[model samples]
Target chain A: MSKQHESVNIIEVKDVAFSFGAEKVLHDISFDIHRGDYLGIIGPNGSGKTTLLKIMLGLLRPESGTIKLFGKDLKNFREWSKIGYVPQKATNFDAHFPATVHEVVLMGRYGSRGLLHRITGHDHNLVRKSLEQVGMQEYQHRLIGDLSGGQQQRVFIARALAGQPEVIFLDEPTTGIDEKTQGEFYALLKKLNEDLNLTLVLVSHDIAMVTKEVMHIACIDRTLVCHMSPEEYLKESHSEKIFGHDVKVMTHHRHKK
Target chain B: MNFLSLFQYGFIVRGLEAGMIVAIIAPLIGIFLVLRRYSLIADTLAHVSLAGIAIGLLLGVNPALSALGTTVIASLGMERLRTSKRVYGESALALFLSGSLALAIVLLSLAKGFNTNLFNYLFGSIVTVTSADVRIIAGLGVVVIVLLVAFFKELVYVTFDEDAAKVSGIPTRLINTLLIVFAAVTVSLSIPIVGVLLIAALIVIPVVTALQLRKSFLATIVYAEFFSLFSVIAGIFASFYLNLSTGGTIVLIMLAIFGAVMASRKG
Candidate 1:
């Protein structure tokens, strides 16, 4: 691909407005997600952060807005294989669902493989490679329910990676895991962002962690409050303005290698 | 009588053939239904099929065909109601189950009260199964199997995580509709051997028993298939020589197996 095409915006949201019944949830939300952008969406509770991500993934439609994915209108865009999704691990699925880790990850290939097609050797290879990428290759044969919360999240991430998507959307991916596993998960995401250059959209409640890790922060509270780099967002007064309080922006220090 | 002697009777032979086919396909649909926690759907559709059978008897048509048509349409309506969230899933099922049973009773009374034909359908009588019935069951069973195989992965994915499957472009709505239609077909086809009252047990008990093994999804289906076939075959033979109700016998055998499995697992 040419440099111009590579640098084009992967997602474009314009004039998006949505409501649940009588109450407005999101209003006048407009933003562009460029290639290789690790954008973290953080907001107060019931602020439509997950809803915004769902709208972008076409899970929920904005009442009034236009969404263009890969320059194609959302309604007409059918190439879903180019994008992947890992929903909130703790709440989205049945923990005891009778799927092996290998089977769960293999589902990521189904969109690209199309309907009525058999799983080929290539598909299996991709599943294996995705498992390996998440460091869960040894547990591929284990039932997904047998794994811990952190391990299951990694399997879900591996499932998204199996699609070889240009972008992956994660909704509260580290909600139930321990602090150590959460750090490892963030490291894995950073490695994917920096090494593989994959566009990422993370919906999270941990503002501090997100601000420290993500390249861009989109603070959403009923609307697009600010879309800027973390440093710029922290320097500005936008955090307190959206949060409705004097938010203390703590910068956690890590020992450099 | 020897085991081979049963095949000498044409009705017994036809019953076994149709029963075995239903046994195989029931679990194929049953595994998905059981895992999705929609087991009551099978029973609800079975009741709907009874109303269809009543309509067929009144109109002098093939009861199985009319039953298939009615259940398929009712299943679609049930799906609509459930998806619309206008009615909770269990509530929707309750509405259809009782509504159709009432319809069946009124229609049966209109057709001149309880008769042998209706009784045969209520509790299965394998002796009444004809070559034509076997042919119909075989033909429609193939359709159910083919559709299940074609959409196997999509169905599993949707059953696992519906929202993720939708995001992956799997046409989750269509797949869900297709599954219920398959269930309708399975329920209708099963009536000749398993009866309206007991078809759900055929469709559900084996899957439940298999689930106790805690295997992978595909392996669970395989084990369910084994249990279903075992129950059907043994139930048919036991009913034949012992003068028992085929549907009742089949369900009892299934319950026995389920009891044994649970007991063994505990031990």
Candidate 2:
């Protein structure tokens, strides 16, 4: 890929509006996700943060406007393998689901491998590499339900990584984990972004943590209230405007330059 | 008669062939259905198959073929209603289950009365199974197995997480439809040996028994296959000598295994 292509906007959302029955959730939402961008979307509960992410992921369609993925319209885009998704933890999965960690991660290759194609040794290697990246390679043969919440989260990330996606969309990835695990999770995301040059789009409600971890903050409350660098986001009054209160911006020691 | 001597009877051989085939394919579809909490769909389809059998007997057609046709169409309708959210899953199943049973009763009455052939269908008579039934069961069993194998990973992926599978471009809608269709076929093929009323038990009990072991998905399916085969084969032999209802004996054996598994797990 050329440098110009590397810097191009990979996702373009314009004038998107959505409603659930009679209740309008999002309107006039527009944003651009550039290559290698680490963007965090934060909003109040039921503020359509996850809904917007779902729309972008093609799990749901926008009522109006358009979404362009990889410079192609979302409807016409067929390259789903280029995108990975980690849904909200603990909500969408059965705890007793009988799948080994290795098997779960191998599913990431299913889309690219297509139907009737056998799983190759290369797919196993990629699954292993993905698990190693998340530091869960040793637990590959264990059932997914047998792992802790933090470990399960890591496995899910590994499953996403196995797809070798350029961009990953995470919906509240750290909702139920402990604070320490949440910190480590954010660090992993940062490493993937900085080391692998993977674009990250995270939907979260932890304003402070998201603001500290993400390069760009998109504050949403039924609309795109603000999308700017975190430095500018903190300096501006967008938090108060969206949250209906003053959000005290905490200063954390920057461990990484 | 000795076990070897039982094979001397052509009907016995045919019944075992058909029963064993149904045993193999039942759990293959059963595991997915059980895991999805869609076990009742099998029962619903079986009930729907009863109405189809009545229609076939009245119209002078192959009841198995007609039942397959009805159940397949009904399965598609059930899938649509479940996905459309217009009807709750259980309620939709109830509607079809009761409505089809009522239709079967009316049709049977119109046909003058339930004959010995229909009685065998209602409760299963392995002794009455013919060579034609064996061929049909074997042929449809291969189809169910092939479809399950070809989409094994995709079905597992969908069963594990439907939303994630859809987002990953797995064509989950098509997969879901294929599963229900497979269920329809399994239920219809099972009716010859397992009977209409007890077919769901044959499809479900083995899978439920295997779940008690808490094995991996593939291992669970293997265990369910073992349980199903054991029940079908053992029940056939015992029913042959004891003059018991074949379907009832098979289900009772499965329940006994389930009970033992539960007891062992508790111990």
Candidate 3:
């Protein structure tokens, strides 16, 4: 909201398009993420939300257009440690993976240290601090697989926080958590955004919750239908357009009661 | 027989030395492979190593060296084929495994016949280990262990989540290449001690046993090496007293240990 931070573009996507064989996933999508922006990308299933996030993260190459991260082209961007990512809640991780919470979080430091470098005391302190920030410090010694889904998500968020990244991208983080846990999870994200000044880009299908939490929303269905403030999106009725159906946008206050 | 008497013979000493070295490195390699769900690749590479051994013997070179060379190529091929997105990783392994087995059989037949000495390489003979074999095992063990320690962090990160590792700037492709190459070296080097048919057991069983205990990653690795060393040492003793196949005895010991671990967990 500050005038000085208005011009800072943490992420800029220009006319990006992607397709898997004949099925076009994303087409000519454009968006901008300012510094300290809490961006929520929402869409229906198979609407290319995850694909756009992957393109921005450089996991998937777009068929066309350019992405700039922190004012540097994504291809040339070398400061990856400054950007953190928590994938869709460890669905790919084995439940019996033999790693403790502390060990899992320590992996975040691997990017900064490169190969062959030993983790210093400063790094260990940061890991502890990150766990503390996420209020999971006491469970640091527990096995990652032993934790519940919500706890695992917190540990993952702590893992991302350990790197001290300026921005973080999360993909469907609250997939399996209960409603109470989801509220707690959103509150944690809100705190991270407001207190630490961490820019966030989260992709989710929970339109009502996401619109309430994020300052800006990007509705995508193959291409970006609109990128506007949550209030503006609700007023303009972008949900029906994005979902390709008569969707209702219930305000967050309805859910609070 | 006294333990000291067992060590008096040069062949027994060499066998023990090489077996111990193989025991250490195989589990170290196995833990990563199992964690990454690439355990089948171990069996595939082991089978491929046989073709290398056969080719080496046909050309009057050291079979172990030839096996190493062949496995390196085959392992790299497996990695490439899996990444091509044309086939599933398991399917790729099956293709390579069958291809290598066919090549081994052809090479064996072309080399006049499956002589008893060459047969020893396939089934493993503890009494036939040379000083050269001992040196090679020691050298390879040191290199693998050193490289593993140096890249431990990166490998762990990559193994847990490859996409996250790549986005984190860990050079996942290079790390994956390193893992497969190390796996090749492990399988090839293990051929002299456990033979082609049983090398996968030496690399995989101990890690599987460790995973059942719910230990942390480093603890899992340490326990795997311990179980591996136990199986090799005990199997050597069993082979010495019972006059059984060294590699077969070792694998059986591992299987027995696995059964016991699983049973205990059930209990």
Candidate 3: where are CA atoms >4 Å away? A1-7, A246-257
Best-performing candidate as measured by DockQ:
3
Best by TM-score: 3
Q: Summarize candidate 1's per-residue lDDT along A1-257 as a digit string, tens digits.
A: 22335577999999999999899999999989899989999876678999999999898889999999999999999999989999987667786777899999999988888889988999999999999998999999999999998999999999999989999999988877878999999999999999999999999877878988998889888999889888877777554665675345312322111
Residue A24 lDDT (model 1): 98
lDDT of 3 by residue, A135-229 (tens): 99999999999999899999999988988899999998988788899999999999999999899999988888898899899988898988888
What are the per-model numbers of colliding residue pairs? 0, 0, 0
TM-score versus the correct structure, for each prediction: 0.95, 0.95, 0.96
* lDDT computed for candidate 2: 0.89
Alpha-carbon deviation at B161 in model 2, angstroms: 0.8
Q: Which model scores highest in lDDT? A: 1
Per-residue accuracy of model 2 over A31-140 as CA lDDT, tens digit each: 89899999999877777999999999999999999999999999999998999999886678888777789988998989878888899999999999999999999999
RMSD, one per candidate, in order: 3.6, 3.6, 2.7
Q: Kindly report which residue stretches of model 2 are placed more than 4 angstroms away from their true locations once superposed.
A: A1-6, A237-239, A245-257
User: Which should have the higher TM-score, number 2 or number 3?
Assistant: 3
What's the distance in Å from true for residue B61, model 3?
A: 0.4
The true-versus-predicted C-alpha distance at residue B107 of model 2, in Å, is 0.9
Q: Judge the docking of candidate 1 as incorrect, acceptable, medium or high.
A: medium
